[model samples]
Target: MNWYQTWNNPLKNLLWWLVIIGMLGSLPLAYMRHETETSTKNVEFVFDYRDLLDIADLQTNPQKFVQDQLGKMKAAGIGSMAVYESTLAEFKESRRIDLYNSRDAAALTQTFGDPSENFTYLLFTNNEAQQKLEPLIQKTFADLGVGVKPWSFKNRSGLVIQMSPDDAAIKAMDPDPIAMQMLKDQGFQLVVRLSNHREFKSNDMDRLLKQLHDLGVKRIIVDGNEVPGYTEENTEENLNKMADLLNKYGMGLAAIELLKEPQKGFSTLAKQTNYNVVRLHSFTEKDGDKLTEPLKKSELEGRIQGVADRFVLAVKDRNIRMVFINGHAVKSLDRAKVVDPLSAYYESLTGTDGAIPRIEKFGFDLGPAQPFEVHTTSWQKVARVFLLIGGLSLVVLMLSFFIPEGTLIFFVLGLIGLVGVHVLSANLYAQGLALMTAISAPSVAVMLAIRTVRSGASAKWKSGIGFGLWLLLRTSLISLIGIVYEVALLNHITYSLVLQQFRGVGLLHLLPIAIAGLYLLFFSENNTYSEKLANIRRILSSYISVLWIVIAGVGLAAVYYYLSRTGNEGQASTVEKLFRSYLENTMGVRPRTKEFLVAHPIFVLGGYLAVRYRHAVYLLFIGVVGQLSLVDTFAHLHTPLHISLLRIFYGLVIGAILGLILCAAWEIVARSWKRWAKPQLLK
Candidate 1:
């Protein structure tokens, strides 16, 4: 005989294989799809721009600034750029001179007419234009002591110069007319800087515009950092006022404020005015020297991407034509003449002809650029845990099949293993484990029972009795174990010694009755016992299915009820009313009962059936009566009842009608199955 012939037939084997494979594949797919879809729908992204600004501030040191900025940008989901050596000494001195004089002056007077004649200028229009002006501005400002304050001159000539310490001295010396003429001869345009800290007056703003027009200041870049206590409304009003003045004077306002709180309003203004504003921070910056320890590139990318996303959203439709990203955002350059890679990426995304326009870079130090990628290896750890559990279950199952005595041992071990898994998975995979155990345990028990009973030596009454008793014992034990594990153990009930004592006492009373019942059932009838056992199995299966459906339906209904009742109006007071009505109809006597009956006719009729047919279908009728009593009790609690005694009696009558429906469904399924399975024909 072939090895396969010793076991199941070809058809049985094929059917078993198909069922197993289909269930295994389908269940995982269903569960995975549901989880994925739920997570995708529910997960939300929250962006905070302030945190990015703080991170950029922390990257003050040139060496670690780029790496630190990058790290923060990834974490905060925003991008920034910090321009290095952009502010020249002459610019700062001019600002201070204006600030000190404007605070006390009577009227706007030109201390130095055409101040642009004393400064170097560079205009950024196109790449070719920038290259052509770069060398010209560099040579013109070199060896020429632009007497202002401590200022460093670099390759770029649109110098962001600092404040002059000796403003009075420069005014006294009157700065050689020829040198002043040399600045004018070089086509220089002085861009005056304004501090946000200065209190704005309507008259002073008018004077400032006139002064800018006299000095040939074509653009005024406002320092956002200096702006104190500027609210959204204040900033908008100030910018609009400045825009009006600048429009009158044929000059434009360039903003360099912290793109933090007032960005939305600023963007709105930018859109309305068609003014382009450049951010002065990089994507990320870091501390510590690279030679000793380097920050993770993956971490930095995440930070940069976050900032970039925010920047894109904030100015996507703004009038801002371009953003000059700070070079320090990518890497630190000592010479302050290198381009930043992150700046280039921003430009690529939000510049002219780019995916998103109005972003560029004023690179102090730009370097080699790399492609962006996100790291998602955290999920691997969770996957490993699931794989381990599955592998262990398979190993135990396979081992059990190979060993004869091992079957029972392994069954016990599997139960223990599942208990351990339940405890462990509750923290890691609670719902998945719950669903797995719910489906697996019952299926496994049924399969094991069928296999054990089918291979029996004889279809004797003793065997049938033994099988039924064993099944009952197994079910009872499992239930007890479940209660202990789920409720007692979980609740910190550590009375194992007391439980053992109780079990010992209970066994004395239970053993004899159980033995006698087993013997009686065993000796009754072999064929009848088997038939009845099969029927009982079918009934049990149906009952379990029905119970599960009831549980799920009731649970869902309860959730809906809770949600519906929770908003503003307060929860419905149904539970108390139903309870009170149940007691009134069921326990009240004579006249009191008559009054209750007259008010609830359905309940009265149901009570009559429960009292009269207290045998065959009374249990079924009682269930219906109980349900109606609950509803009536809740109603009574919620509102004062104004019905007549006859109406009460009529409500009980309605309950009786529903009781009849319940009995009909029950009998139909029971009788239908019985008629279909004729034991005599099978015999």
Candidate 2:
């Protein structure tokens, strides 16, 4: 019969259309249900654009900036804010600019910069109060003459900032001598040094220390050099001696002079001796060379924040309490010292005058901050729907057997409809359990019905057996094809590269083919006692193929593990290295290949022998092993090349072997059946 003739059979055509249409319609509903169910339970509020604001800049316009930020918070339904600062010098020194330049506006808003120029403000209220705050904050910013634009909004978490100090003006303010004296009088440790001019004699150092002591200054930082015209070595020795003298005097030493090179060794010594603070000199010529023109505020914040986080971690590790952050390299050590430009910029962007729409349009409210609440469906509802669909499919399957011949088409249609429902359930709800239950229950029912309908009469029994066998073979082939398709698709140059390139996602693409294999196995027929025994023998033979592939996988894993652990390249050949690399990159876990081979040599050898003989059971075993390895490998590894190549090779090898095996098995079964029938005929 032509393909069209078979497919166009009125009953078959109807079943096919029913199956296709049902599956197509159900998927979207299932996906929707799944998403709704998953989302309802844990509603988290994420900040929309966090990095856009630089806290350091907020010091320039604290009130206006904060009010503007408050407006965004009101719109987004954000309740709380956390603020941190990064040093200016680090910001200029780092690659934050590149990062900012590469990112889109949305990404640009996630990080904040230099806390010294900013202070965090959080708005708290019930949902109603929050709704009122957005417009109010916007108007407030407009009244202050700060151009407010909407930057981004979040439903739950948001950040805001306030004022910063002026750098140049603060730099001009010198320490008051009386104020210094008063601090000394209060028994506080005080260190004073000239901002410039490094040269000093040992006698000069002594006079300075003595003068400070007379003034009740308990601690002093002086030029490290003890004598003018001293050699570098002498200068170094003098500095060390001066440090020791300070310790002896029960005082702290702060080095005012910059070391020619910042030595890790000297830093270690200074740390050990509690020299507490070591000030770096002006930015080196090399540093100046590295600085780029037109420093972006976003880039500056990222670099600054990175340094701050690192410094915090380092200081915490060392148990250090106070560290002086220089204005030149570290920016502001205290928030009261510098303006945060980025924060002001962010406020301006997120203000009422901003280009972006109000937060409500984006499914959020801004103002009095409140806990986020997202609309979603309950899992119980999803479960009930699934149960209803499954029960209906089961009922249809049971009715198929007891019904008349003409009604078979209706039963088939119902089965197809159930399959459609399963697909729909999967797509809409993403509930694998529901879909599986729906699909499997109907399949089981159909098998049972077929078994029952064929049991009454001899002719009917013969026809049923033949049809069952054909169905088994068809299902098995289809399942094998699905497996091969999956494996072939996976074969690529690099699994990671493949994953990186993946953009399209279709509903049918996501289903696991292994489930199809299981379905085929469950529906397969073994009628007579001899036929059942033959099936068992075939299954046993298939184990041999599985054994061979398992041995290979284990062997490859062992070599990879040994190579990786020992870092010994010489032990493995190029081919072995390639294979090992593929396995390791494809499968995160390394298997013990050598050990497995040693442990199961008999099984491995038998499986290999069966493959050589083109045994169908062995081929099936090989395919299963390959499928399992591919699945496990894909699950663990990020690289696609290894996965793809391994899958393709596995499929091709297993498919070829299995095809031959099936042909041989069919021939053998046919011959045996014929011989048995002939004896019965002779009788």
Candidate 3:
């Protein structure tokens, strides 16, 4: 006789389907909002390819690693890569035991400078140190099979060796000419690093230009520690002459300046050239004691504005095509700052356009399982969708058979299905299927929530807004976990380092949630709204000792907060910056937004409700949203680090403490209200 059990109610079934539609609509809205802000700036990302270029990284399937990194760049729409140009160190070391056999260390140092001001002490004492260092050094070389032999690695660009006698010899290092050709052949622009200051001498200009032109190299990153053979006073004049020579060769010059004050030299150079890229290099110098302090937004913004004042506007006025804000992110937080609003502001000033990588347009075939294949399809094409619905429906009904009386099977089912689909959707067809799930799962949740609320046999079902929201919150948390895992795990992406392919939940990810909804609506126990709340309340209060329970929950939250961001000092600093940026984006200066007005209130209310009414799910739902946003915030791999780690601690621990306080406070109010009032709201 119950309404949920009645097979005759056609109206209730239709109502169930309507809520499902609303759920699907939220995704694309979320996706479009995060994809790109409308802008006209021609901003392109220039990533340092060191992690991919290490001698060790090269040996462990270099091609695959290249492909992986390439896929990441393509996904992020990266404009160019800064590649390391080897000097004749390998060639020099081939016949000698000394570091200086091939390298003009003093001459090179004049331009590029010692890596640090104090490196001279180490370098000058090398002869004395050699006696002590020789055995260990020789053992290392021998272990790596480098006895009196020039060492090199192969790639699409050919053989890149550690030692080459001269600039001309460097070209011969390319082994896979065809593979190396792929970089130029596929429209991948290059920004080669200039070795020492000598590479930019006026006399050597022609040779450098000819070689670069031949290799299709267009840009050069000048590491002018002090401009070799030229006084610091001639920096502007020399740069102007170099720019003119490069322009004649149809090449561009990039000047990288440290993130310091009075960038007069670089700013003067910017005012002089139109065919150029200027980078404000911000990095943590280990020796100079850089990035040791926590970053502040106001300070960072001031620095960005300083650079903007110096060159961002000038670069734009001159219509320069690219600008790089190059900073090394050795830590998670540092990486986050690298991609924050300050960086975005630079791009906004410059412009953003055509950053989507042309993966298929890449001239070389990167094998069949290429990660960049597009996966959309026309609606009329696939008739299997109807069959898929039936199949999923059947599976859900079957899966529901095993869930216990009180457990929410929908959450479990949805997580498994989405996680599996996300993991398994490797090919085109499966990708399409995954997309379908994303669109369909929201509607399914609406339907499930409505059906559960309309349980008893009646002419009209009860309004289930509260119950529906509870379902939404629960499934959303689970879905978030599954989707975050899929995107982060599949791409092997970390802190936007490897780059992520997708930034939002897709059909493949939604399939599991949809299946779980079906199980919850039709086959599960008929636990009503009152029953669910009572059970939840019991678990929070009388089910166990409240003080012990609060401590445990708070402890777990604190641990999750710490482990996720703390470990290595660099990592901790990095994560701190990352989380701070995330907070600023979500909670900063937003008085009317849902995150500020609703979820945060719900989070507090849920805590109070849990203490007073024993409803823990509501509080948990809000926390998970914050946690998930944390994932999706950095999910856009281009989002570099720039926040403090303490914000995360405040969010998790303080929120937990506040909840405990609210719970106690709510309990006191409920008791007073019951004692004084005729009609009670607490019960």
Show where candidate 3 strays beyond 4 Å: 1-40, 55-76, 90-182, 213-218, 227-237, 249-265, 274-683
Ordered from best to worst lDDT, the candidate numbers read 3, 2, 1
Q: What is each predicted model's overall lDDT from 0 to 1?
A: 0.33, 0.34, 0.37
Residues 452-513 of candidate 1 have per-residue lDDT tens digits of: 33333213334322333344234222212111111111110011101011112122222322
1-683, model 3: which lDDT tens digit per residue?
45433432442343224323332322332233223211113444455544334421324464565566555555444546655543223222221122331334445334453343221011212233334333433333344343332221121111112322242233212112232345666566666655443434575556555666787666665544432223456665677776566667666445443233332343333334452433323222231123223458665444443333323222222222344433322323745432212233333233332112221121211211101111222321232332233223322322333332312344345446755664666333333333343333333333333333344221132422233234435434433322322222222211111211343342222333344444443333466656766755765586456897898899679646534532122134555445543443344311212233333345545533432232343243443334333233323332211221223333444444444455567668878877877365554
Candidate 1 segments whose C-alpha is farther than 4 A from its true place: 1-193, 197-221, 225-244, 250-324, 327-683
TM-scores of all candidate predictions against the true structure: 0.22, 0.23, 0.29
The candidate that achieves the highest TM-score relative to the unseen native structure = 3
Question: TM-score of model 2 relative to the true fold?
Answer: 0.23
Q: After aligning candidate 1 to the native by TM-score, how far in Å is the CA of 243 from where it should be?
A: 6.0
Which candidate has the top score in lDDT? Answer: 3
lDDT of 2 by residue, 1-683 (tens): 45544433454335334433433334343334223222211111112111223332334563355356545543532332211112212122121111112123234456654433332222322343234333433443344343433332355322231312122111211223333453344333444442213243455446545655565444333323322223455555655565555455545433322244332223432433453332212222223222222357775544333333322322222111222222111244443344333332233224332212222232323221111122223443443443334333333332332332333454556557756755775333223323332333323322332333233221233332243234333323323322222222222212211111222221122222233233234323435546656766787687557889899799779545534433112265666655654553344223323212221222222233332232322222223232222322322212222333444444443443444454456557768979897789888
In model 1, the number of clashes is: 85
